[model samples]
Target chain A: MLLLQSALVQSALVQAALGALPAARPTWNLALPGQLLGALGPDLLLAGGAVLLLLVAVARPESDRHQRAVGWASLGLVGLTIVAVVAYASRGALATEGPIAVDTFRWAVDIVVLIGTGCTIALSMESNPLDGILTAESHVLVLFSAAGMLLLAAARDLILVFLGIELMSVAVYILSGLDRRSERSAEAALKYFLLGAFSTGFLLYGIALVYGATGSTNLATIGEHVARYSLMYNPMLVAGVALLLIGFSFKVAAVPFHMWAPDVYEGAPTPITAFMAAAVKVAAFAAFLRIWLDAFPTVAYQWHNAIWLLAVLTMLVGNVVALRQRNLKRMLAYSSIAHAGYLLVTVVVANSLGASAFLFYLVAYTLATMGAFAVVIALGEPGERNQEIADYAGLWTVEPWLAAAMAVFMMALLGFPIAGGMGFFAKWYVIDAAIHAPHPQTVLAVILVLASVISCGYYLGVVLTMFMKPRPANAPAVRPVPTGTFLVIYLSAFTLLLFGVLPNGFVQLAHDSVPISMVGAPARAPVASAASR
Target chain B: MYPLFYSFCFYLFGLIAIASALAFVTRRSPVAAALWLVNVLFCLAALYVMLDAPFIAAVQVLVYAGAIMVVFLFVVMLLNLGLPGELADARGLLAKILAGLAGIVLLAKIMSSRTAVPIESLMLRPDSLATVARIQGAVAPVAQPLFTEYLIAFEVTSILLLVAAVGAVLIGRRRAAAVEGVGAG
Candidate 1:
């Protein structure tokens, strides 16, 4: 009766009274859970091996000779992490309230990021000699950064997400400026570092405010609390959520926060650019999608319009600006920005359907974008010269296989019905998801189509430049494609084409990969009641 | 009488913190600016103490005022940027206007929210500081969960540190490479 009467007292007083109780202490689980370790196994292996790789570099003499070997080692690390990911994912999703999420969504994104990293490594090994950017540790930095991406993919707690973002961004800042002789590279690094730090500040502040509002850092707990309290209109939570979205927008290069992408992409080595464009975007979107779709779904109605405006503006501005770029890297940068816009559409849909569509599109986008960059690496010469659209003219005559491969990637990007192979299916699923959303983003669906149509102006421009225009007399001779770069381009084109033709199996896998948090009434009944106890 | 004294201390620290922050930013000499920033940090720590978050207050004094201020002073000395004269400020009119507007908006929001909102009815426990520092001692409450529930974050933070270290190495290695290039040429 006294305990019952205590419940009616002030909560702060109740908390203090409970703290004073001499009941058997609820023992803290200091021993890490087996499921937690299994879930984290891939990230641990990648990070631990990256440290070993750095140590190896520290021991060895600084020489260009070690670069290719280090690059291969990094590729091997990615391959191993992928194996671990698949092994764990096969056991099915682990329902975790821990900092790390172990589910199909994380496994899927991990695979995509690893594939992108592998291609980047292979391309880097091939091209670093030509560019005189043969820092042996650059490959190890890529490995560390990919490990960070894996962490980002799995992070369920806001603190883990912050650590992941920092680990990812710092390695990339160094990688961007690896070609120390180039002033452009220095400018790219400085700009990226400054802007990245700024966005991180926003993210941390958002996390702090959200923690303040919800009294929890775990995404599931936050979601549960938000729903139970009907805190969708809470000013502090609203501002925090907005800032978090803005931070993710900057990372994914959505229209307003995309100023750094073009310069960073153009100035970084092409392979690193591909990693940034493909893997970085994939990881950031994975966390963003999971965080919002899981933790902030209760407030989806509030944020839908903001994301809608972002998607609309991102799509319009990205394509319109991409249309005018003559430089191929800058063009690809804007194209990636445009792709970021399309991805934001999946976010706007805000359901398991959107999540599945996002997974499917990421796979398609990763393959084509990395392949196109590999082609760019093959075409461009030392000092990153001869990369203009005009330089790509009559590429068909010089290297028909390379030109054909480049065209496949370009058409894939454009989402042409037959020629694009997998890209059309990817776009089809996204539009389907948008139309079928709880809010039915019919207008956004239409905007997505119009944006895709605008994108054709640039994607097809590259293909036409390669096939239709006459080769300039002063066009730099296409370099002999290295074995690693060739392998990446060939495999990417082949896989994308195959999937494009028969996407049913892949689509099923993607449909299954939606984060488990979105599958039902997330986290069961009201958590506020549980918190009160 | 006690409540009045407590609030008086709060206001004293708060006003001083704001004034020192302004001074920190406006000072022409970099060393003077850095010292003023240290003063601002000390005021913040004092306010934190009044708020009953002594751990945070200690951290504020030790990390920000002690360690970080030293680093700032070192940088100011190394760059010889302490000279007040000829250090052209980049403060434009637009920037000044924006800053003033931002300060006014912040103040207005604080004042209005305090008056209008029934903040106590929000169900947020007003005394979270109790749970923050109970347990076996002052440090145990924080250290316990940090090593137990938040252990994974702690482990991941090490990777962040490693990445930072690798970045510093890359920068150093690049400088070496550049010098070698110059010598060879």
Candidate 2:
């Protein structure tokens, strides 16, 4: 009789617990959302492809042939992803709000990141064997990192953003140290890992503090709360925003936080360096814009001064320091920092026009930078030797085509009008956006022009060195450029020139790619204007 | 009345945890510091048990307080570190002052925030969590959220972990091979 009573009480407890569980949770539901594919198709495809490639890598031992095959396969996968992104982008954004984005902006970033990934794979395929890195796993790491980048482009919530950052960072960290024989590569990896982890800590703490202040991590929801409550000056929110700005500064390699870029870029393999400078920068900037525009529009005023200061410091420091770098790789690293400053100008605008301008500038920047890195690989010998600025002193004498192509890349980076081609229009639109902002950043526009002039000291220095200086008496013979790398360089230069002459269509596409939800977020206007975001 | 006892135990354990953490930092010997860390972890586990999360408490004791602490002790012994005076510590006056200032400021902020921003309305309200915990047992409280609304993040975390593990193995093996080659030569 006592045993039966105990059993009855246990059953009663179980039923009571089950009954209260539903009432205790008022807002949350366990049912899956209605739609998923239109937003997440490309990311899922990329992840699937990467996992399969990783398995393939596990099956094969490290070999030059295996590496090449993996490289080609990675490029093909990136191509398919680009096709999916373009198709879905035309279909418009998903109607429902979720953790991941599926807008034209996200798709545009996807295409740009994939372009960089494809080129990096081609370049690495040519250079890896020469460097004696036979691991097919390196290609798999690149694919994994690219998938992470795609996720970053689509992240709509803070937690997703953190995961995306980690996924991208872990893969890139290994890729940087793939040439393990070199002590410099190991040092680069360790420094990058330690410092990157530290920055991630700052990012997480900021997210936590923001969550504490407003009780939401969803960007759209946070924006609504901030607008409705007027939490702009709330001390906690301000501190969270400040920390977030600092964290992103580290990620994007802005001045005062870019101590790692030069050493790591120089020590890393050239292909990985290009990936860092192009795709990594693009992804970080895209996420930065997304978070700032979508989540913190009410408190956006808090960051304008801070961003303006960073932009000025980054531009001045990056260009002035680049003039002193003799190593081509380090110089390009610092140049990327300067470009980061230019990108920050667009963030300052924080309007539809600015995002549109950012898309165009980023595309042009990627093309020019990738073409330049390809040329760097073509000219560099094995073991990363002979990459000094003077090494290409008389490239026009032995290899006129390579020298001319190099000049085109340099001029484009310098933003020279006709010579720079697409680069000129890219810079013009950024300045146009800055000046036409609700409150004009006229001083910033002028500073940008001055920084470009300062950058000419190095960009033109490369061009003049190639055209005017004589080749050394015992210079090494020019290498035969790989067909894949040659194609990358040719396409980039051709597109830059072609678009420089006629930029109407590209401009329209850039304009169209601006996030529709962010269209009303001009300066001094509350982003609450975009309903149903 | 039972809930009051739970809060009393929480405060007691929290105080012990804080004191031990301070001692852990200040301890001269590495082993002593690690032992203090174990003490703190135990207090945390006991506090977890008071909340009726015996599974979490057991796991915390097993994984962190026991296993990870043993590793720490092993590393401390293996390194054979020197005297306490030689061990790295915050020696500079400026650093000391700055650290103290930061701590004081943080304390001030928390104290001031007590009235202005109570903890209840903030992101991690304990009331709702307690009810959920009663229904879900020890791990379910965490796993419920992880597998449900944040399912994608949870799945992607596995990919991140796999990538990290593979990278470590690949890098470690290459290093070992190079060292072996050197030894053979």
Candidate 3:
């Protein structure tokens, strides 16, 4: 009887030890609003600026001076936000424990977006009422859109990605139609809204399917599930990924889904066009890269072929269609589509070097595209005339400096001689990345080179018209470049050239900004579980 | 004891939903069509309730039938569309045939997929009376995840609504300006 009692006592002790195992499970701590604000500093700043601009508009109704003040204030806010992002990056604080991530990648993308927005504001500073009625609301819309871009770049959750896309898209749709007097602007707005809403449906459906398949919407949790389960062949996951690819393809204006680009790009205000082309592309591509690299890295082989086909088709269709375009804005729109193809190739490579190349190419492309559009803005009168290639005839003689800026932009866009501009280096880096990828994509690299050569047909067409073609008798004389536009053109051109000649420093920055540990890798497990929760 | 009654209610709601949806699409007048849509929504809500999701059923009635139907009525009344004949289908016969074919194909695909995946196996819990009692309360399970894991999404939805409101005002103000300018001229 004594022995049996002792055995029971030992059994109780073993049961107590086994019950303590679950105490090791990590418990999540809720982030405070103050901490969230610190992590999302740039987004909050831009949002606050937007609200302030709206209040300013309401208080001082329609005064042009007040509007200009609002514009400058918006510019200052964007500039300050860039500084904040850089500061946040320098602090090396990883506050990405919540839905948003404030890592080096986010900071670099934020800087790109903010700089593009600032340049756009400068380009729009001398707003012609006839071209588009620039209200304080325009600047406010831009600020809100920039906030959305920041959120998108930093989004670590699928829900945040959807919200960020919506916020950015809605603001842009309104901005696209801000020129109330232009029927084309209204049409652009309507078409973009309809198609954009359709694409958002696909995106939401994809998110729903992904959540259903993985039982989680948190990207890290999804990645963990994928890694643990080897869910590559799940039909629901495959469908979700396809829908997501389609949705992003529409946003980036990849061919077969790019029906809205040329019209929307041409009909929107010139500065807004530049802003959309640069900032929107950057934001969308950033989200695309993050989502594919983080959540779906385990299934890379499954989706890589689809992306490959998209890249090829986008490059071919964009350049070929652009060759037939006579309007300069439409041509640039097609060129932008072609560039999207190149960017998509880098995404397919899906390596740290590819990420760095993507960033570098984005910088080069943003500068060149914005600079080119600045020239367009400078030449355009109140009614948005002088958009034809013929309109740019003998531009070299009329405005030598503006013509020279346009030439530099064209050469950069063409990816000419290695010494010609940054675009060449950007292309080279992307090709190098493709070559060095785990599964080298030599075919894609060849297609990229061939497509670049084809693109020269249109980009050089603009250059040739500017320098060689004589002024048509009916062509309007070039308007004197505004100081704001002149500043934008020279700054972007100078940066383009400097980065081209000495790309090492910027290349290092790009390399350092790559979120290598975040992509594909599981997040760190929580250290200490809540004691006896 | 409950199986026969449950299937009866399920089929009743499902048939009503399908029939009302067809009627909603085929109606001549916008107001009549909207009323039919409300009926369809109510039927779907009933179906949801029968499927052990009372919260979703309530939302379906409140959001789809009440709120959305009101908006539809408002728009139809605002436009005062002239006649059913004027709004009749204008597509070619070939297009109509193609659309019908596509619809049939989609229906077949859905049916096949549904058959391939047995609904009994898809259930998270055994379909017993006790399990039903345990699982029927839908709000708490959904509310927990929505408030915790998806709190950011919920907040962002509010922002999206705000953006939509602002965009509407901007576009509406522009239209008003254009109309005023035309009136003055």
Ranking by TM-score: 2, 1, 3
Instruction: Please provide, for model 2 over B92-182, each residue's C-alpha lDDT reduced to its tens digit, 9 standing for 90 to 100.
Output: 6788688889999999998987888555556555567666777766577777777877888888899899899989988987887788778
lDDT of 3 by residue, A230-322 (tens): 888899988988899999999999989999999999988888889889999999999999888778889877888999999999989999999
CA RMSD of all predictions? 12.5, 13.6, 13.6
Error of 2 at A488 (Å): 1.8
Off by over 4 Å in 1: A1-32, A520-533, B1-27, B39-54, B66-135
- CAPRI grade, predicted model 1: medium
lDDT of 1 at B135: 33
User: Could you estimate the TM-score for every candidate?
Assistant: 0.84, 0.85, 0.84
Indicate the DockQ of the complex predicted as candidate 2.
0.60
Give the candidate number with the greatest DockQ.
Answer: 1
Candidates 2 and 3, the one with greater TM-score: 2
Share of true Cα-Cα contacts across chains kept by each model? 0.88, 0.73, 0.81
- Candidate 3 per-residue C-alpha lDDT over B1-185 given as tens digits, one digit per residue, 9 for 90 to 100: 39999999988988988898888767777778789899999999998887766777899999999988886787677568535754566545788689889989999999889858567866666764336545656656667768876776776677667667877887888788789889999
Off by over 4 Å in 2: A1-34, A519-533, B1-27, B55-84, B88-127, B135-141, B183-185
